[model samples]
Target: LRLVNMRFECVGAIDLLEFNICNNVEILNCDFAPADNDVVSAISTVNSSWLTIRNCRFSSPATDNGFDYCLYAAGGSNKNLHCALIENNIFDGMDGDGTAIHIEALCTASQTVIRNNLIMIRGAGIGIDDDSDQAMVIENKIFHNGGTPLDVNASLSLMNMLSDDGTVTWSPTIAGLSA
Candidate 1:
């Protein structure tokens, strides 16, 4: 499946886009704006492989409860994501306990690449959270988030990244990051 050059505005749903058991999917140059504060995610994927999301923009409203994510990818017990590439996207206006991008339950040693993105959120949320150890996060600009900019569970590599928390701009050095 391929979705290109589209605009999704004021979409009132749990997930504006959902993909399950899909392969070779591409979403490019799209814009997403959730309706009010009732939306959960802009895009969600389950058991998908070889997915690419690039050059997209996502915006959310400020909510008390806070939504889940701008983009989420999850694999089941039997099904696991093989490879996913998310790059050159912009995620903004997220608040509370939400995440801009969340990747979880990937296959062992499956490589997921997150690079060249701009993520800015409010409140105590995360910019990127990867449960898999095989993620490569590089060249992302994260600003004004109250929580961790990049959170990886195990050994992953992060390079050429910039993060700011309104007062300080610094590069985080992670232990066990491979060269």
Candidate 2:
């Protein structure tokens, strides 16, 4: 499946795009901005493989009941993602405790690349939350978020820039930038 050059707005109470048990999916040059506070995620993938999401924009209105995420991907033991690429995207103007990007339970053999993205959230929100060593997080500029910039369990994070206030501080052991 391929979705290109599309605009999704105000899709209420659900994910704008969802992929479950699907493969070889591509989403490019898209815009996702939901005014509804009940909206879950701009994109959600579960047990998908070979997926690519690039050149996209995601934003949501401020809500006390924070939405889940701008992008969410999860894989389990039986059905794990073989590969995924999320790059060149922009996420901004979000509020509350929701995450910009959330990934979890990826297969050890699988490779997930998240790079070259811009993430800025208004309130106490995380920039990225990845819980897989198979993920490579690189070169993303994350700023103005009230929570952790890159909360990753991955072993391959490189060249990423993060700033909550005017100052930026990160533990090299946490980000895996050092031995």
Candidate 3:
């Protein structure tokens, strides 16, 4: 399914788009806003692959004090998922404890890419709980957040990057802390 240039508003803690066992789904140029929800999210995908969420906007309550997530994607323990991408999106007015993007531990995302995103938040930024070996988080601008910017729970899962020519090498950091 493809959701493009659409608007979705939620009055409660319900996901705007939730899917499972599906593939090749794309959500682009969409607007998702939730009103006064202490717990909710805009997108939630489970056990799916080839999912792309790009050029989208998300807005949540500014007074929420509980768990409120913007996007939640999981693949479970088995990790059969193929690929997922979140890029060129904007997140704003998030006011809660949860992260803007939460990648669950069970998800073994083979090729998960989160890049070129602007995250302006009043809460946490992003969280990756799984060992996404092929995960690439590059060039994301996260600021004005009340909580940490990034969190990777799978300590050993964080990989070192080396250029194809093997000249450049770098490692990921968790909330500005060396990994």
Number of the predicted model whose TM-score against the real structure is largest:
2
In model 3, what are the clashing residue pairs, if there are any?
76-106
Rank list by lDDT: 2, 1, 3
Q: Considering lDDT, which of the candidate structures 2 and 3 is the better prediction for this target?
A: 2
Off by over 4 Å in 2: 61-66, 106-109, 169-179
Task: Answer with 1 or 2, whichever has the higher lDDT.
Answer: 2
Q: How good is model 3 by TM-score?
A: 0.74
Off by over 4 Å in 1: 10-13, 61-67, 105-109, 153-155, 166-179
Model 3 lDDT vs. the true structure?
Answer: 0.63
Q: How many clashes (backbone N, Cα, C below 3 Å) per candidate?
A: 0, 0, 1
* Candidate 3 lDDT tens digits, 1-179: 88889998767667777777658989899988875565466777777788888999887556463236677766556544457888889877465555677776667666777777776545433433233444566666665434556554333333433222223333353465442
Alpha-carbon error at 13 in model 2, in Å? 2.4
At residue 16, what lDDT does model 3 achieve?
72
lDDT by residue (37-146, candidate 1, tens digit) is 55677887777778888999987655453447888777557555567888999988465777898877454327778888998866778888877656777778887546
Q: Alpha-carbon error at 127 in model 2, in Å?
A: 1.0
Local accuracy of candidate 2 as per-residue lDDT tens digits, 49-131: 78888999886555553356888777576655557888999987455777888877554325878889998856778888876
